[model samples]
Target: MASRSVLGDIRRDLEAYVGSKIRLRANKGRKKIVEREGVLEGTYPNIFTVRLSEADSVRRVSYSYADLLTETVELVVCTASGKETKFEAHSR
Candidate 1:
Protein backbone atom coordinates (compact mmCIF):
# COMPACT_ATOMS: atom_id res chain seq x y z
CA MET A 1 0.00 0.00 0.00
CA ALA A 2 1.30 3.41 0.91
CA SER A 3 4.40 2.03 2.53
CA ARG A 4 5.38 0.25 -0.64
CA SER A 5 5.16 3.48 -2.56
CA VAL A 6 7.25 5.25 0.03
CA LEU A 7 9.88 2.53 -0.17
CA GLY A 8 9.86 2.74 -3.93
CA ASP A 9 10.57 6.45 -3.82
CA ILE A 10 13.40 5.93 -1.38
CA ARG A 11 14.87 3.22 -3.57
CA ARG A 12 14.74 5.42 -6.62
CA ASP A 13 16.49 8.19 -4.78
CA LEU A 14 19.24 5.84 -3.61
CA GLU A 15 19.75 4.35 -7.07
CA ALA A 16 21.63 7.47 -8.06
CA TYR A 17 24.23 6.86 -5.37
CA VAL A 18 25.32 3.52 -6.72
CA GLY A 19 29.13 3.33 -7.13
CA SER A 20 29.51 6.40 -4.97
CA LYS A 21 31.15 6.78 -1.59
CA ILE A 22 28.66 6.89 1.23
CA ARG A 23 28.62 6.98 4.99
CA LEU A 24 26.16 4.66 6.71
CA ARG A 25 24.80 4.75 10.22
CA ALA A 26 22.61 1.92 11.40
CA ASN A 27 20.88 1.10 14.65
CA LYS A 28 21.31 -2.44 15.85
CA GLY A 29 18.75 -2.26 18.66
CA ARG A 30 19.46 -2.14 22.40
CA LYS A 31 21.02 1.31 21.82
CA LYS A 32 23.79 -0.07 19.63
CA ILE A 33 24.92 1.98 16.67
CA VAL A 34 27.12 0.91 13.76
CA GLU A 35 28.80 3.34 11.44
CA ARG A 36 30.86 2.79 8.31
CA GLU A 37 32.13 4.49 5.21
CA GLY A 38 31.88 2.53 1.99
CA VAL A 39 31.02 2.59 -1.61
CA LEU A 40 27.46 1.89 -2.61
CA GLU A 41 28.09 -1.18 -4.70
CA GLY A 42 24.77 -2.35 -6.02
CA THR A 43 21.05 -1.79 -6.07
CA TYR A 44 18.31 -4.36 -6.46
CA PRO A 45 14.54 -4.26 -6.61
CA ASN A 46 14.24 -4.35 -2.85
CA ILE A 47 17.69 -3.74 -1.42
CA PHE A 48 21.08 -2.14 -1.89
CA THR A 49 24.57 -3.16 -0.85
CA VAL A 50 27.52 -1.24 0.49
CA ARG A 51 31.07 -2.52 0.40
CA LEU A 52 33.37 -1.79 3.32
CA SER A 53 36.93 -2.77 3.92
CA GLU A 54 38.37 -3.47 7.34
CA ALA A 55 41.95 -4.67 7.72
CA ASP A 56 42.34 -7.37 5.09
CA SER A 57 38.67 -8.26 4.95
CA VAL A 58 35.97 -6.67 2.91
CA ARG A 59 32.38 -6.69 4.08
CA ARG A 60 29.28 -6.16 2.07
CA VAL A 61 26.09 -5.09 3.84
CA SER A 62 22.68 -5.10 2.27
CA TYR A 63 19.85 -2.97 3.58
CA SER A 64 16.32 -2.48 2.39
CA TYR A 65 14.87 0.86 1.44
CA ALA A 66 12.23 0.32 4.09
CA ASP A 67 14.97 0.51 6.67
CA LEU A 68 15.51 4.13 5.70
CA LEU A 69 11.82 4.90 6.03
CA THR A 70 11.86 3.43 9.52
CA GLU A 71 14.98 5.39 10.47
CA THR A 72 16.89 2.18 11.07
CA VAL A 73 19.52 3.25 8.54
CA GLU A 74 20.85 6.60 7.40
CA LEU A 75 23.05 7.41 4.38
CA VAL A 76 25.28 10.29 3.40
CA VAL A 77 26.65 10.39 -0.13
CA CYS A 78 29.77 12.36 -0.94
CA THR A 79 30.16 14.05 -4.29
CA ALA A 80 33.32 14.60 -6.30
CA SER A 81 33.26 18.27 -5.40
CA GLY A 82 33.29 17.45 -1.67
CA LYS A 83 29.59 18.04 -1.21
CA GLU A 84 27.61 15.69 0.98
CA THR A 85 23.97 14.79 0.61
CA LYS A 86 22.07 12.99 3.32
CA PHE A 87 19.28 10.63 2.46
CA GLU A 88 16.63 9.44 4.87
CA ALA A 89 13.05 8.42 4.26
CA HIS A 90 10.26 10.12 6.18
CA SER A 91 6.50 10.22 5.91
CA ARG A 92 5.04 12.97 3.83
Candidate 2:
Protein backbone atom coordinates (compact mmCIF):
# COMPACT_ATOMS: atom_id res chain seq x y z
CA MET A 1 0.00 0.00 0.00
CA ALA A 2 1.15 3.57 -0.66
CA SER A 3 2.05 5.66 2.31
CA ARG A 4 0.51 8.99 3.26
CA SER A 5 3.68 11.03 2.77
CA VAL A 6 4.17 9.62 -0.72
CA LEU A 7 0.74 10.73 -1.78
CA GLY A 8 1.45 14.17 -0.36
CA ASP A 9 4.62 14.36 -2.39
CA ILE A 10 2.75 13.42 -5.53
CA ARG A 11 0.21 16.13 -4.87
CA ARG A 12 2.92 18.74 -4.41
CA ASP A 13 4.69 17.78 -7.60
CA LEU A 14 1.51 17.93 -9.62
CA GLU A 15 0.64 21.33 -8.19
CA ALA A 16 3.70 22.81 -9.85
CA TYR A 17 2.45 21.74 -13.27
CA VAL A 18 -0.97 23.28 -13.16
CA GLY A 19 -1.99 25.01 -16.43
CA SER A 20 0.54 23.05 -18.47
CA LYS A 21 -0.26 20.71 -21.32
CA ILE A 22 -0.30 17.08 -20.27
CA ARG A 23 -0.82 13.66 -21.76
CA LEU A 24 -2.72 11.29 -19.53
CA ARG A 25 -2.47 7.51 -19.73
CA ALA A 26 -4.92 5.68 -17.51
CA ASN A 27 -5.27 1.93 -16.99
CA LYS A 28 -8.93 0.95 -16.99
CA GLY A 29 -8.45 -2.60 -15.77
CA ARG A 30 -8.72 -5.80 -17.84
CA LYS A 31 -6.05 -4.78 -20.30
CA LYS A 32 -7.71 -1.51 -21.19
CA ILE A 33 -5.84 1.77 -21.39
CA VAL A 34 -7.14 5.23 -22.22
CA GLU A 35 -5.05 8.16 -23.37
CA ARG A 36 -5.91 11.83 -23.65
CA GLU A 37 -4.22 15.17 -24.03
CA GLY A 38 -5.23 18.04 -21.82
CA VAL A 39 -4.22 21.00 -19.73
CA LEU A 40 -3.82 20.71 -16.02
CA GLU A 41 -6.66 22.78 -14.59
CA GLY A 42 -6.33 22.77 -10.84
CA THR A 43 -5.01 20.78 -7.92
CA TYR A 44 -7.06 20.34 -4.80
CA PRO A 45 -6.40 18.50 -1.55
CA ASN A 46 -7.25 15.02 -2.78
CA ILE A 47 -7.52 15.40 -6.53
CA PHE A 48 -6.57 17.50 -9.54
CA THR A 49 -8.61 18.41 -12.60
CA VAL A 50 -7.76 18.53 -16.27
CA ARG A 51 -9.37 20.22 -19.25
CA LEU A 52 -9.29 18.08 -22.38
CA SER A 53 -10.33 18.56 -25.95
CA GLU A 54 -11.94 15.45 -27.30
CA ALA A 55 -13.50 14.50 -30.62
CA ASP A 56 -15.82 17.57 -30.83
CA SER A 57 -16.33 18.03 -27.15
CA VAL A 58 -14.39 19.62 -24.33
CA ARG A 59 -14.30 17.60 -21.15
CA ARG A 60 -12.98 18.04 -17.65
CA VAL A 61 -11.66 15.15 -15.57
CA SER A 62 -10.19 14.72 -12.16
CA TYR A 63 -8.09 12.02 -10.51
CA SER A 64 -6.64 11.42 -7.11
CA TYR A 65 -2.99 11.56 -6.11
CA ALA A 66 -3.30 7.99 -4.94
CA ASP A 67 -3.95 7.03 -8.54
CA LEU A 68 -0.44 8.22 -9.41
CA LEU A 69 1.08 6.55 -6.40
CA THR A 70 -0.52 3.25 -7.33
CA GLU A 71 0.58 3.52 -10.95
CA THR A 72 -2.99 3.46 -12.18
CA VAL A 73 -2.59 6.81 -13.90
CA GLU A 74 0.44 8.19 -15.72
CA LEU A 75 0.98 11.86 -16.57
CA VAL A 76 3.37 13.26 -19.11
CA VAL A 77 3.81 17.01 -19.06
CA CYS A 78 4.61 18.66 -22.34
CA THR A 79 6.82 21.72 -22.18
CA ALA A 80 6.77 24.46 -24.73
CA SER A 81 10.23 23.62 -26.08
CA GLY A 82 9.03 20.18 -27.18
CA LYS A 83 10.24 18.32 -24.14
CA GLU A 84 8.21 15.63 -22.44
CA THR A 85 8.60 14.93 -18.75
CA LYS A 86 6.86 12.01 -17.11
CA PHE A 87 5.53 12.46 -13.58
CA GLU A 88 6.08 9.63 -11.17
CA ALA A 89 5.14 9.03 -7.57
CA HIS A 90 7.28 6.63 -5.56
CA SER A 91 6.26 5.38 -2.15
CA ARG A 92 8.97 5.47 0.42
Candidate 3:
Protein backbone atom coordinates (compact mmCIF):
# COMPACT_ATOMS: atom_id res chain seq x y z
CA MET A 1 0.00 0.00 0.00
CA ALA A 2 1.12 3.52 -0.69
CA SER A 3 1.78 5.90 2.18
CA ARG A 4 0.21 9.31 2.82
CA SER A 5 3.34 11.07 1.68
CA VAL A 6 3.20 9.22 -1.61
CA LEU A 7 -0.34 10.41 -2.19
CA GLY A 8 0.71 13.94 -1.39
CA ASP A 9 3.50 13.69 -3.91
CA ILE A 10 1.13 12.39 -6.53
CA ARG A 11 -1.19 15.33 -5.99
CA ARG A 12 1.68 17.76 -6.21
CA ASP A 13 2.86 16.29 -9.49
CA LEU A 14 -0.60 16.36 -11.00
CA GLU A 15 -1.17 19.97 -9.97
CA ALA A 16 1.59 21.04 -12.33
CA TYR A 17 -0.37 19.70 -15.27
CA VAL A 18 -3.56 21.51 -14.57
CA GLY A 19 -5.13 22.88 -17.80
CA SER A 20 -3.09 20.50 -19.97
CA LYS A 21 -4.38 17.74 -22.18
CA ILE A 22 -4.05 14.18 -20.94
CA ARG A 23 -5.13 10.63 -21.56
CA LEU A 24 -6.07 8.36 -18.72
CA ARG A 25 -6.74 4.68 -18.33
CA ALA A 26 -8.52 3.68 -15.17
CA ASN A 27 -9.05 0.12 -13.97
CA LYS A 28 -12.61 -0.49 -12.87
CA GLY A 29 -12.12 -4.02 -11.63
CA ARG A 30 -13.68 -7.15 -13.18
CA LYS A 31 -11.23 -6.73 -16.08
CA LYS A 32 -12.79 -3.46 -17.12
CA ILE A 33 -10.70 -0.49 -18.12
CA VAL A 34 -12.02 2.98 -18.85
CA GLU A 35 -10.02 5.24 -21.12
CA ARG A 36 -10.55 8.85 -22.12
CA GLU A 37 -8.97 12.11 -23.16
CA GLY A 38 -9.52 15.29 -21.23
CA VAL A 39 -8.10 18.54 -20.03
CA LEU A 40 -6.62 18.57 -16.56
CA GLU A 41 -9.07 20.70 -14.65
CA GLY A 42 -7.67 21.09 -11.16
CA THR A 43 -5.97 19.23 -8.38
CA TYR A 44 -7.14 19.30 -4.81
CA PRO A 45 -5.90 17.81 -1.56
CA ASN A 46 -7.48 14.44 -2.23
CA ILE A 47 -8.70 14.39 -5.85
CA PHE A 48 -8.20 15.94 -9.25
CA THR A 49 -10.78 16.81 -11.88
CA VAL A 50 -10.77 16.44 -15.64
CA ARG A 51 -12.94 18.07 -18.24
CA LEU A 52 -14.10 15.55 -20.82
CA SER A 53 -16.09 15.91 -24.00
CA GLU A 54 -17.83 12.95 -25.57
CA ALA A 55 -20.22 12.93 -28.51
CA ASP A 56 -20.91 16.63 -28.16
CA SER A 57 -21.61 16.26 -24.46
CA VAL A 58 -19.19 17.69 -21.97
CA ARG A 59 -18.69 16.33 -18.52
CA ARG A 60 -16.18 16.30 -15.71
CA VAL A 61 -14.59 13.40 -13.93
CA SER A 62 -12.63 13.23 -10.72
CA TYR A 63 -10.03 10.76 -9.49
CA SER A 64 -8.18 10.50 -6.23
CA TYR A 65 -4.41 10.68 -5.80
CA ALA A 66 -4.56 7.27 -4.16
CA ASP A 67 -5.76 5.91 -7.50
CA LEU A 68 -2.56 7.09 -9.15
CA LEU A 69 -0.38 5.98 -6.26
CA THR A 70 -1.82 2.45 -6.47
CA GLU A 71 -1.64 2.36 -10.28
CA THR A 72 -5.38 2.11 -10.57
CA VAL A 73 -5.22 5.19 -12.79
CA GLU A 74 -2.63 5.55 -15.53
CA LEU A 75 -2.18 9.11 -16.79
CA VAL A 76 -0.32 10.31 -19.84
CA VAL A 77 0.19 14.00 -20.43
CA CYS A 78 -0.07 15.23 -24.02
CA THR A 79 1.93 18.13 -25.23
CA ALA A 80 1.05 20.73 -27.83
CA SER A 81 3.79 19.30 -30.06
CA GLY A 82 2.01 15.95 -30.13
CA LYS A 83 4.27 14.28 -27.60
CA GLU A 84 3.03 11.96 -24.89
CA THR A 85 4.65 11.23 -21.55
CA LYS A 86 3.38 8.78 -18.99
CA PHE A 87 3.20 9.83 -15.35
CA GLU A 88 5.91 8.22 -13.25
CA ALA A 89 5.34 7.31 -9.65
CA HIS A 90 7.77 8.05 -6.87
CA SER A 91 10.25 5.24 -6.35
CA ARG A 92 9.73 3.14 -3.24
Instruction: Give the alpha carbon lDDT tens digit for every residue of 1-92 in model 2.
Output: 66778878888888899999999999999999999999999998889999999899999999999888888999999999999999988887
Compared to the true structure, candidate 3 yields what TM-score? 0.91
> Candidate 2 local accuracy as lDDT?
0.91
Question: How are the candidates ranked when ordered by TM-score, highest leading?
Answer: 2, 3, 1
Leading candidate by lDDT: 2
The list of candidate 3 runs beyond 4 A from truth reads: none
Q: Which regions in candidate 1 have their CA more than 4 angstroms from the true location?
A: none
For model 1, name the residue pairs that clash.
none
In order of appearance, the predictions have TM-scores of 0.91, 0.92, 0.91
RMSD of 3: 1.3
List model 3 lDDT by residue over 1-92, tens digit each: 67778888888888889999999899999999999999999998889999998998999999888888778899999999999999987645
Q: In candidate 3, which residue pairs clash? A: none
TM-score leader = 2
Per-residue lDDT tens digits for candidate 1, residues 1-92, read 34677777877888888899999999999999999999999988899999998889999999988788888899999999999999867766
